[model samples]
Target: MSTHFEERSGVILCRTSWGSWYQTMEEVFIEVNVPHGTSGKEVRCNLGSKHIELHVKGQEIFKGKLFGTTVSDEGTWTLEDKCLIRIVLMKTNREAGNCWASLLEGQYCADAWVQDQMQRKLTLERFHRENPGFDFSGAEISGNFAGGGPDFSNLQK
Candidate 1:
């Protein structure tokens, strides 16, 4: 519901999350500052079933899938002035029926991005509504960010 950021190890971390009837999903994005005078120029990571794409300064730099799942993806980058990482995950009705089509029909899709930081911990999450014209209650992100930071620790059932 909100967006928050924190500074750790010369990297800026962002977190966001959202809730639904079947599950609660969260996403994390990281931006690392490359060392001075470096020429490599780009870095990226992707995982899960959601084929994530990463871009630097509006240019596609990294592309890949999240593990064996096609429901999440992430990307990272370091530029001359700053570095950024983004992660996205979706709640999919991969089931074999039309259950999703019966819940969210004709409703405006609501999507949100949030970041929160308290004490020594950071949280980033994104919420997306998968309104497929029909009444489909379920939703998913279809895109995400790459590596860095903790292993999506706050995501729970």
Candidate 2:
């Protein structure tokens, strides 16, 4: 069965957990969420190097490979609330222009960022394992960050 998901308004009302991406200079953030009334216990999200799978209510809503220039499986996932999750896909190239054009046909090690991200993920995992019960909370959960130069069009250049 195929996962059916789409974005409408600021909500992620889904019959299946599909996804949508909005990109920046350095990352692609894919939004996934379960339909209203679906409890957190009823949802599962598997984030991989080249694909992501989201399941809810014991049925898979999303299971698809990702694509793009220099896409790293080394992304981050966070529960926006009790009903939503955000996946952060890092960009390998700073000047690749827009990468949201393609996101379903690529290899994990196809880019240098893959290596870097692998290391990063491993480090984070190790840290968490070593510091069991340590809370890294209160950090910037928002994935939006620097992607390129800031435009000061209203001011004098």
Local accuracy by lDDT, each model:
0.29, 0.47
lDDT of 1: 0.29
Off-target runs (Cα >4 Å) in candidate 1 are 1-25, 40-157
For model 2, what is the alpha-carbon lDDT of residue 149? Answer: 22
Candidate 1 per-residue C-alpha lDDT over 1-157 given as tens digits, one digit per residue, 9 for 90 to 100: 2122112112222312211211123222323333344344454434444454544444554454332232443323234444323233443422211111111232211232211111112112222122123322222222233221234436773
Clash count for each candidate, listed in order shown:
46, 4
